[model samples]
Target: MAESKTNAMRLLDKSQIPYETLNYDHEDGQIHGTAVAEKIGRPQESVFKTLVAHQSGQISQICVFVIPVAEELDLKKAAKAAGAKKIEMLPVKDLLKWTGYIRGGCSPVGMKKLYPTFIDASAEGLKIIAVSAGRIGTQMELNPQQLAEQVKAVFFPLTKEA
Candidate 1:
């Protein structure tokens, strides 16, 4: 059964954005994007992982990226997309403070603050993609464009060439 509404889900509701919840099994420790995709029974490319990153010397400017679980974030490309000199993933310890989300369960929607967010351009043609529902054992599915709009995100080539 689907669990109760998460903060992310609640916000989606408030925005009147249509989405579907997907429940999956999760282990106690960190779960990789591929494992998440498998648990949710979706193609690896259709499942995205939310990453928190920031440009050097600009810790206050947090950037969010929603990219394929199977792909690696191309720091150089992502930095360019965000108009930064360089970009690096934020430390895991600081994730909650910056984004109000944890490592494995982070979602682009309903963050502590709306920072600059980007969805991998590859998500453009895909009909739907799955992301964390702001908690473990859960995911949400919807059109990538809709997700981007809800979070005021840009579509950019932020992932390494696959």
Candidate 2:
């Protein structure tokens, strides 16, 4: 059943990141990340969502953000970390093309390209965390360090009060 979803299972197999797959009835038109956390009975802080952003100016760069659902990404801090002046969230279509995942189900692993990946420093404190397995109604639990390693991510203080 888990293998039915291509994206998440692909990463699990490719990276050899041991994970437990969880499936729940995904409510139609539900608000995303938070709802998934609630369904799994985990604090929103322990569930991260992936976002894609594009930097402006001559050196345009595509970046991936992995942050807790309960926290807001500090654009300034992210820009500083990415060596950009400003960063803007990319359109959903662009996100799909770049990350190979949809808006509500993006995962840092198994992306179409290896962009600059940034994971909030808070994630480092957790022994295990959940992230989208590239689709709605599906999630995976894995060690934060292994997740970062698989994505080649840089840990930084990229989050702030929501």
Candidate 3:
């Protein structure tokens, strides 16, 4: 397992959050989110992708968004939910520095900073959702609500129809 995945597993255990780890052979340049779902035999809609965004303006606060792989993040909705006037996707370099995970491997659980987290409303009814366990080849399956509670995340309708 990769260091990032190991770190994530350690965090989840320490948090006492019930989760199951999955692994697969990661393909180069493939979208990790969809790849994870396919490997786990779950629908892509139940797999979430972690994205980093920043409030617009100089020295704006950074935010992390977790939404289903099949849906698109509505920045306007996310900004409104976050109480920020505007929002923009953070560059990969900054995302790595802030989250300590590179693009395609960013997980909301064990970030360098505890940014405000938002989960797409669609995840509410699901018993378990898949999220990157800080690596391309691994994923974590856990209760969506519990996951949100663990991160103090706020749920919002920030996703567009898949």
Candidate closest to the true structure, highest TM-score = 1
Candidate order by decreasing lDDT:
1, 3, 2
What does candidate 1's lDDT look like per residue over 37-95, in tens digits? 88889999899999999998778889999999999999999999899999989999999
Q: Sort all candidates by TM-score, best to worst.
A: 1, 3, 2
The C-alpha lDDT values of all candidates are 0.91, 0.82, 0.83
Clashes of each: 0, 0, 0
Better by TM-score, candidate 2 or 1:
1
Show the lowest summed lDDT stretch of 10 residues, model 2: 1-10
lDDT string, candidate 2, 1-162, tens digits:
325855656766777778887776777666477888888888998999887888975324799899998778888988988998998888776776667778777878778888899999999999999988878777888999998888889889998655
Instruction: List where candidate 2 sits over 4 angstroms from the true fold.
Output: 1-5, 58-60
In candidate 2, list every pair of residues with a backbone clash: none
Better lDDT candidate (1, 2): 1
Q: Which candidate is the best by lDDT?
A: 1
Badly placed stretches (over 4 Å) of model 1 are 28-30
Question: What does candidate 2 score in Cα RMSD to the true structure?
Answer: 1.9
Q: Over the stretch 33-61, how does candidate 3's per-residue lDDT look in tens digits? A: 66667777889988999988988883348
